[model samples]
Target: MMCDLETGICGPAGEGNSEMELIDLTAPTKKIDLYYVTDPICSHCWALEPTLRKFLEEYGQYINLHTLMGGLLEKWDGFADVSNGISGPGDVAGHWREVGDHTRMPIDGSFWFEDPVTSSYIPSRVYKVVQQKDASLAPVFLRKAREAVFPFNKNISNDQLLIDIVNSIGLNGEEIVKESHLPAAQESLQEDFIMAGRLGVRGFPTIIFLNEEQKGVKVVGARPYDNYVQALKQILPEENIQPKAINTLQHVLQKEGLLFSREIEELYNLAQQDVAAFVEKELAADSYIVEEVLGEKYIQLNQ
Candidate 1:
């Protein structure tokens, strides 16, 4: 996939198609298979986190979500994006800042300049290790890795850093790292790379929604929330497939273990300041854990 500097997608562009038809999901219970193609260090994927989470939260019951690593950066050794004129890690710092501003996702791009990740392959492979062990943990590790790199400037590509992220999620980090070196984990990541190619995916943030018959509608790029919803509707056209809604801020907090101001802003349609006010109220209730980091808030149930 050719990298587009303007979009931060290392792939060809795909328009959201809403074909009219219903195919039975292969899984007996779910309606669609959502294949999420993302990378650990993809700034655009990081920008997409809130929208992706809200989509899953509302429709997760009807969908089986699968995480596929896109291997965004094999190595920065000879990397050069002519369109964006980015030849190395430092070149991406400003672009990340712009993405953060545009998406309302807090991103500290200083890591690109300070603790640059030479390759995203390491974390991507480690993701395969976790996925091989527990499908649930794979996405959890992916989220944590992105949280570490995007806002905290942690080098996700580093060995120790990847292990630490794994450890934070209750895994034996050293064992996981050792397991990652095994043939199976690396092979798993390679399979994803091959699948991405076969699926005509050339970039980060590419999601293909497939019905039971395997007919798919691909939504590419960091699109608005409506685009994704429309794509899902097109695939299933069933009015009953309604999005699940939360009645209150506390309800939402109860659903998600951790909440970013940006995530809550998207989830409940609240302004950033209002998120602050509501979170403040929750904090005063004495049942929430709120941490202020780099001028932002991370809220979760105290338990």
Candidate 2:
């Protein structure tokens, strides 16, 4: 089966639903090991950013999150995702627009029309190289890559844009770009693909939770906030997991640096109608910079 646009499940044509793996954790460091399998260009993965951020903020103390790239599109060879009603790359434009509208995230989806990406492998490999260089920088680089493609209409498969993103994170963009072309980067991405296959993963935004006993549970798709919280609770029922309130924009932006109005709305517990007013207040009162993109407001802390 092809990818389902409604569920935001992007995978190969014939992969099954993800089943939790019982891999042996050799003296697991944390109470839970979270393998976050996602794609840089996956629409649902982009949608999961807000909820995923809250999950990490609230329960990050008890979990060790490992990001694994799920190979989504590898040179779309006349490929059509029948399940999602996408005939080609041009079809993705409208679908992603709808996704942005529903999720309240700032996604432009115009890249598919302006300059469509041929393969996700290039950017994914760049991320793998970044992951190899510095695990901390990889997340930021990936986020920028997503922001580039989804909202900014950047073709991340290109080397120059990828280099710019690396430089933004205070890393040596030239050195990293040079290494991303090597075989090792591809190998690292391949390893992730093998693991995803072993786990029977069928889409992007698949989170696998494993406890000390090596027992695992899978949470698939861009689900509601409670679905993620409950998944963590299921694995660590014995331990007390009090979800920290997502009450501060400064705290969240300190790490992420950039956030959209809807993202702040979700984290701040504001109603959809109040999103504009809340973001406007934050900008006008506290002196934050808001960048408008595709009819959405993105607040960024002054650097």
Candidate 3:
């Protein structure tokens, strides 16, 4: 199997396509470097959606982020190899049940019971194709794909579904599909796989933080906001990149749903013990955003 040198992927696995290509190191820019290694089909990736978005929204100014598409199981060809079926929508239904208790994000298990997916490559590759053409809209494409599969319950494996998402997200759907077939798009995805292999990335939503100095740290699996911040701080100790402060929390809450105590602590340097009760009181009064209980405390936005 040939390497898709353009996109930095290793091509299909199990065909002796496993080979690592060293990433060309470059001088760090004003923005901190962050790479989010993920696959479209990864359920954990879906669960990490909210935290990742908040991370981007809050820290986007300080960092330049890129997404690497790690190919999970490509097809339903090997049924036994899969814990769930690519063709059998019901096969994945049970997975939702298992993951729901783990991740607070809502997953309508009926999606697998009713609208199972057959392939994740098309949607995943579409991200590469769009990002290659217009790097700015990469996140938009990624979010649209997630919405299509996990929330809207659309089959991203199909061209029509991809087209619909493209149009819905205000992108040129036809061009995206055309590029999905293009050699350039394929190359980008292949290169992404190669990069993932070299990084020893074994799971979805593997976030790598590379500071301006080229020092790197890795966070595996779906994690909270602090997990990312801790990794980033390891690389850039000077980074005072904290969450929105309590005085400013009201503003941040207008946009984001869930808020963590650590975010406030980091962003505003607020003492967690002091602010905890006030935040809870505000939440009880309906002046804040509230979500499920994690520990003795609930996560709330400063609404």
lDDT preference between candidates 1 and 3, better one: 1
What is the C-alpha local distance difference test score of each model? 0.81, 0.84, 0.67
**Candidate 3, superposed: residue stretches over 4 Å from native:** 1-30, 79-89, 109-115, 242-303
For all predictions, the C-alpha RMSD in Å is: 14.5, 15.3, 15.1
Prediction 2 TM-score vs. true: 0.85
Residue pairs whose backbone atoms clash in candidate 1? 11-202, 24-212, 25-212
lDDT (tens digit, per residue) of candidate 2 on 1-303:
477666567777436544444654433245788999999999999999988887887778778888999988888787778999987788998989899888878678777876888889989998998888888989999999999999888899888888899999989888888888899988989999998887778888899999988898899999999998898889988776776666567667778989887787678778767876776655545557878987888888887
Query: Candidates' TM-scores?
Result: 0.84, 0.85, 0.67
On TM-score, who's better, 1 or 2?
A: 2
> Candidate 3 on 220-269: residue-level lDDT in tens?
99887788867766776755555432335565554443444544454444
Ranking by lDDT: 2, 1, 3
Question: Runs in model 1 with CA error above 4 Å?
Answer: 1-30, 247-257, 280-284, 300-303
By TM-score rank, best first, the candidates go: 2, 1, 3
Clashes per candidate (backbone, < 3 Å) = 3, 0, 14
Q: Which candidate, 2 or 3, has the higher lDDT?
A: 2
